[model samples]
Target: MEVNLIVETLKFLVLGMSTVFMFLALMVVVLELQAKIIMKYFPPPKENSLVSNSTQELFQKGNFSVVAAIAASIRSYKKKSK
Candidate 1:
């Protein structure tokens, strides 16, 4: 009877540990799946234009050539000016 009780206790202990491990594994899988789904549907925000207002003001004026030159400039001075 003592041997039987020991065997039963060991069985229950193993069963409890396995149940805990399975629950933790399931939780990790669920969290990973949720992260992947959120990443797939929700893209990161993009950088908006900082010089749109200035560009619009230049476009409104008759400085089309200046705008073109500024756009084609290699030193990015136009970006800094805005």
Candidate 2:
């Protein structure tokens, strides 16, 4: 009777361990699937900005005189602070 009890306890332990492992495996699969779906629809971010486009256009239009004047004004302001 003692031997039978030992055998039954061992069986229960094995079954419990297997159930835990199965649950962990299912969780991993679900996480991976969610990542794939999010990436497919949302995608990653980009670094492009409208300010950069406007700056490029300013350079192309020969507006350096305006830029120089603005820089000089900033320099004068800085000098006044000192």
> Whose TM-score is greatest here?
2
For all predicted structures, in order, the TM-scores are 0.47, 0.55
Clashing pairs in 2: none
lDDT of 2 by residue, 4-80 (tens): 98888999999999999999999999999999999999887654333443535666767787667767988999999
The candidate scoring highest on lDDT is 2
Stretches of model 1 off by over 4 angstroms after superposition: 1-3, 44-82
Model 1 over residues 1-82: C-alpha lDDT tens digits?
2579888899999999999999999999999999999889996665443344465677776668867876788358767788
Stretches of candidate 2 off by over 4 Å are 1-3, 44-74
Residue 24 lDDT (model 1): 99
Instruction: Mark the 10 consecutive residues where model 2 has the least summed lDDT.
Output: 47-56
